[model samples]
Structure formats: structure tokens, C-alpha cells
Target: MSTLTLEVVAIDDGVPGIRTLTLASPDRAVLPSFTPGSHIVIQCADGANAYSLTGETTSPREYVVSVLECPQGRGGSRWIHRDLTIGSVIVAHRPRSAFAPVLRASRHLLIAAGIGITPMVSHLRSARRWGRDVRLLYVHRKGRGAYVDEIATLTDSASFFTDRTAFVSELSLELASQPFGTHVYVCGPSQFIDDVVTAATALGWPPSRIHVEHFGGDLAPGDPFEVELSCSGDVFTVESGVSLLESLTARGHAIPNLCHQGVCGECRVPVRAGSVVHRDLYLSDDERRDSMMACVSRGSGRLELEL
Candidate 1:
């Protein structure tokens, strides 16, 4: 639960509606090191928002993250866009990684779309540093791509597309032709990830070889459910519009959490009974069997938790 006080050393409006923040320590200390595809959760004005680290991972003095203003999001990116500026200080958690490089894979195939390119940049940075075999298939809207220029300097094996249909057709061919040890890493909307995973599975790609980066998404207002604390036998009714974590906190129970979006695995609790509608990106299917992330996941029936 440690935190870092970061000073906004610089801000860039180079991309429309996207602000790139360069953060450094006030006393010029070297920041905590992170691996490729790592993200740090920033305490925003509204709530904590997680952004992928797109800066150097080795002995870096500053950390960089690009925030795209999400109109339909839960107001964290809106706060970063409107209120933050140079010389402003913000609090952030140290980098936590869930999407990391597969060191044993023979080759890395990275796929990204729109703001999903944020995490891929960190992946490419690591591939360049250690001479790892890597390729990127980036799909972005016309003239709205982020880090295209930067990614060009890293690897010439990248492919860019503006047409979704063309990209999917090409991706199907690529997925089928990769070598035996090739692994695919993808980041985008939940549906997009599902489509990519489906296509890969159809192409005989093993589940172990397809990695996904699941981050922010608007949670659906699931059916109302109730959870009982196994410790105290106190039950809390989770309403349609409210999350289980929100309900617990509103009832004066403080749960340690970082990303309200379920990308971080901080608020996961052991499930003692009932079924879980797995919505979090941080948990594996095996891990989801007996545990649930209270941030964005919902349950059915009288869910019992070891909370």
C-alpha cells in the first residue's frame, strides 16, 4: 500500500484528446523499476485510474503514461485532462505488472488498437533493450494512433492498419503461420479481445499462447445480489448500480483497493459460497474458481465471502 508523490515534469498534447504525462520525483530520486507491460495506479481527483508505463524500465528517473480522455469512462481520465498541469503533484502506486513478456517464447506477436497501444509501447521497449524477437500489429483509426512514431524507431516488424476488416483478415493469416513457440499478446476492448482470442483458438493456438490485457471497461449493472461476510455474518445488499466494494465501503467497511476498474488484483477476496460472474481482468480462470474481485465483479444468490 506504499505510494509515490510524483511531480508532473512535462505534459504533451501532441495527440488530440490524449495527454502524455512525464512524472518525476520532487527530490530527483530514481523511481521504482518496472517490467515491460507494467502499469501504475494513480490517485486521480475522482478515483484511482491505472495507466500502463510507457517509459524506460531500467534505472529511470521519470515515469511516463499517456492518458486518453475517455468520454464514457468513470471520470479519471477526464480529471487528468482538465485539471493536471506542469508542476502539479500527484500520488501514484508503484508499478504492478500483470501483462509481462513471455521470456521462453521464441517470438512475441503484439496486437493493439487505439489507446490499447499504450501497453504495447512498453513491450516494444523491452524487446529492443534485450534484442528479443518481437513484432507489432497495430490497428488504429485514421490519424488517431498514439506512439506510431516512437514504435517505428523500435522495430521495423510492425504493421499498421486503419481498416478493421482488413486487419482481422490479415491477423487470421498471421496467427495460423506463426512458429511453434510464438506467443500473442493483445490489448483492446473486451469484445475485441474476445474476437482475437476466438480467432486464435480457431486457428489451433493453444490457450497458453494467447495472452490478453484486460483493463478499463464500463461494468454492466448486473442483477441485484447479496453478500454475507463469513467473519461477522453481516450481509450487505448490492444494488444494481453499485459495486460490491462500493456497498461495503458505504457500510463503513474499508477494503484495500487500487484500481476500481478491476485491472489490479488488490481487492480480491476468497469466495466461500455462491457463483461469481467473473468480470475482472486480473484473475485467471483457475484463480476465479474460489475468489472474486469485489471492484467490478458481481455474484449470484446469497454470495458468502471471507471478507
Candidate 2:
């Protein structure tokens, strides 16, 4: 995959922990176009952390991404907040989409929990432009704690600032009453996503119609495992200290991997042998049956994958 090493032209504080970084375009032609809910891997002081593009990627002029400073985890978002500055050069991979909004659905029910609002904000914007009916249910601890203003702009948007109980009840009722063509997107903390998924499933919503995206929190990294590539006939021994993307890149095998945390799903490959320990927030059961994301996930044992 082609990458653009663009300079950070401008940076602005969007909210308390969020900042918007405007990247200078590398090329003067039509920029890489991405749909709503698309993300690009930005190389920062702390490796690569994927950020969803807030604005539309229409021209070759600029790109905007809102980064919520993460104090914990691996310091990726914190590095962007503290270290990244105007005129600082950073390698940015072309836009990738693992959480794109499903356009086939006539109606969309967007549920965002805290920082997860970033991707859904973009989806809401695109949906509004297309004249599609969208209802945003933003769940937050307090009205001031979340990106409430951003969510308020969308049509039929509701907020639950008190607790999860009220949010789940309202979400269940809203989803149950909606037509069958409605698509539901839930993104936030792992537990929150799980709760929303469980509730929606209990309401008889199709699992395929529910999409989710997770960023951080006690995501226990799995043990390193060995992998054998079927096409290249190459074997790789991923050490415990490194990820599969890093391990493969250290060797001669250049697998296109961006956002090493597995959110972008760029390094997904067909699984031919052995069981894989899936770690990504995306990917359905059908996708897991044939493929595995090589970045975050590791093999249970010796595995064979299509290179």
C-alpha cells in the first residue's frame, strides 16, 4: 500500500482530551476518497494509532482527524496530543475502512459511547448529506463529559447522560420499533459494545446488521505464535515481544499493515490451517472462519496462512 509522509500543518483543540490534526496533502491530485466511518493510520511518536477521518476526503488539500488523548494504553493518542505539532512530518497511510456505514440500510441507528463518537460523527454527516434517516443515541456519564454537541446536530438524536440502564432501555425500544432495514452501529468501550450488542441481539436484530468498533482497555495481548505462509512457503516465528506485523516486517516478507492495533484490518489474510486467537474488535463469525487479522491476533498453535 502506498503511504504519504505529510506534515502536520495545523492542530486545534476540539474538546477536553480531543484535538484535531490537519495534515498537509502530499499529492496535488485527487486525494484518496473514503466513505463514512473510514480511518487512516497516523504514524506518531508512539507507533501507529488509527484515527477516523472526521471530515470528508474529497480534495487533495487537507485531511482532518480528531484524536482523543489516551493517558493509558500504549501512549499513542497521548503522543499525538503532547508531541505532534504544526509542521511536524509524519507518515500517514492511505485511508482504510473497517467500520464503514452500511449504505444498503434505509435507516441507521447510531449508538456512540464516549470517544467512540468520532467514527459515528462522520457516519452521521454522510448520512445527512445523502438524505438518509438517522437517529443518534449518545450514551455518556454526564452531559458535559461526552461529545454531545456533535451528536445534537444529527436528526432525531437523543442523549442518555445518566446511566446505562436508561440508554439500553431506550435503545432497545428504538431498535425494536424500527423497520427491518435499519442498521445499528455501536462503538465505545469493550463492555459497552458488548452490552449494546447483547441487547440488540435479544431484540431479535440480526447480528450481521450490528457493527462495532473498540479502541482500548484491558485488552490482554495474546502470546506470540508461529505461522507458516502457504503461498510464499515462508515460516515466521513471532517472538513474545513483537506483534505479527512487526515480526513479518522485520523479516523480508512485507505484508501491508497499517494501524498495528488491528482496528483497520489491513493485515487480514486467509487462514488455511490452525486456530487463530482473534483479538480485533471488528470481523464477524463468517470472516473469522476463513481469515484472521495478523496484527493483534495470534495463532493458538502452529498455523498456516495465505501470504
Candidate 3:
């Protein structure tokens, strides 16, 4: 993946603990065009965090990303909130999309859970620009959901439900009103995506129409596994409870990784030989047959990587 240098122009608090970062690129050159549900990975002082593109194409050079202060895990969010300042130069990747809007559908139903609102925010903008009918259902824990007012101002009809039961009922009605071709985009935690998929599948929505994006919190670093680097012809033993990427980096091997949570697919490597116990959420079953996400996945016993 190609890396671009960006300068922080401004950072503002959109809601409590959530800040929107405005980045400025050189030459007044425009960034890449991204679909409604696209997200860009930004490298912060500590680590990397993936944020959905909230800025419009007309303002391409000024990329907007919202960060929610995390109390646990890596320092990606907290550093952005506390340490990031104007004139700070950071490395980032251009917009890459996984949960793009389904163009074939005339009507759309967007579901966002908690911080999952990031990607859905861009979808609303794209849908509105194209004049596609859209509705947003935002579900959040009590006192945790942020930016409800901002979302309501931009969407056609926006509703919030703190209670899971009420939220599911309203979501079911929305799901029922639309026909089979309607597109459903789900974003949030693993449980949120799992629940939405289960409910949508039960409601007769095709599996192909439901797209999901995970916002961190995935597999626990598994037991140390063995990896045979095909290119260098060397075997490395990853320590227990350490990610394969970390193990490789600790041994002075150069490899790339972004969202270690398995969503970004930046650290994916091909398997040359041996079996791998795949754990990433991005890859489908068929894709896992020959590849593995080194960031969050581990080998079954010993595996060979094309590296």
C-alpha cells in the first residue's frame, strides 16, 4: 500500500470524546474519489486508526475523520484526541472501501450501532447527493451515542433507539417494507453485525446484499504459532499471545499492517504451504483457503507464508 503524508489542519470536537480531524494535502491536489462507505487509515503518534471519509468529493484535499476516545487497547484514539495538533505531519493511506453502497437498489436502509456511525455518515451524503431515498437507524448504548443531531440534519429520516428490543422492532419494520433488492449496510461491533445479519437473513434478505464493517475489538492474540517465510527460507516462532505481524516485526522483518483488527486487510499474506487457522472477519470461507490475515490470525500448527 502506498503511503501519503498529510498535515493536520484542524481538529474539532463533534461530540463528547469524539473529534473530527481535517487534514490538508500538498499541491492543492485532490485525494482519491471514494464511495459512500469508504474509510481511510491514518497513522497517529502511537498506532493507526481507520476512519470513514466524511468529507465530500468537491473538498477532496480536506479529508475528515472522526475519532472516539477509547479507554482500552491501543492508543490510536486517545493520542488523536490529546497529542495531535495543527502542523503535525502524519502518514496515511488513501480511501479504501469495503462497505460500499449497493447501487442496484432504489431504496436504502442504513443501520449504525454506536461508533459505527462513521461509515454510515458518508453513505447518507452519497445517497442524498444522488437523490436515492434513504433512512438511518442509529442504535447506541445509554448516554454513549454521539452526533445524533448532526446525523438527523443530513438524513431524510433519522431515528434513535437506546433499547435493543425497540430498536430491533423498528429495524424489522424497516426491513419488511423494503423489497428483496433493497441494500442493507451494517456497522458496529461484532455482536451488532452478527445480530443484524441473523435478523436480516431471517427476514429473507440475501446474504450478498448485507455488507458489514467492523470497528475494532476482534480476536484475542492467539497462542504463538510457527510461520515459515517462503522468500527468505526461514522459520519463525511467534510467542504465545502475540500477533504474527508483531512477531515478524520483532525479528526485523519488514511487513505492513494497518488495522490489526482484521477489517482493513492491509496485512493479508498468501499461504504457500501448511494449514492456517484463519480468524479474520474480512475473508470469506473460500478466500481463507489460501490466505491469512497476519495481524489478528494464527496458524493451526505450522504454516508457510509466501511473504
Ranking by lDDT: 1, 3, 2
The candidate that wins on lDDT is 1
Off by over 4 Å in 3: 26-29, 142-144, 218-259, 263-266, 271-290, 297-307
lDDT, each prediction: 0.88, 0.75, 0.78
RMSD (Å) of each candidate, 1 decimal? 3.6, 5.0, 4.7
Model 1 agreement with the true structure over 1-307: per-residue lDDT tens digits? 4789999999999989889999999998999999898889898877688899999998899999999889888889998999998999999888887789899999999989888898899899999989999989999889889999999999999999999999998898889889889999998876678889899999889988988876675445778998999999998789887888899889788888877888667889899999997777567678888998888889887799987
Listed per model in order, the count of residue pairs whose N, CA or C atoms clash below 3 Å is 0, 0, 0
Q: Would you estimate the TM-scores of all the predictions? A: 0.84, 0.76, 0.77
lDDT of 2 at 138: 80
**Sliding window of 10 residues with minimal summed lDDT for model 2:** 141-150
For model 1, where is the 10-residue window of minimal lDDT?
Answer: 213-222
1 or 3: which has the higher TM-score? 1
Candidate 2 lDDT, 1-307, residue by residue in tens: 4687777888878467778888876553456787788777777665677777777645546777887776866777888898888988888778876777787997888888777777887787787778888888887655324446655675555555458788778877887898879999888776777788888888888877988776633244556688898987888788774677777777776788656677656788788989887767446668999888777777887889887
Q: Predictions ranked by TM-score, top down? A: 1, 3, 2
Candidate 3, which ten residues in sequence have the lowest lDDT sum? 214-223
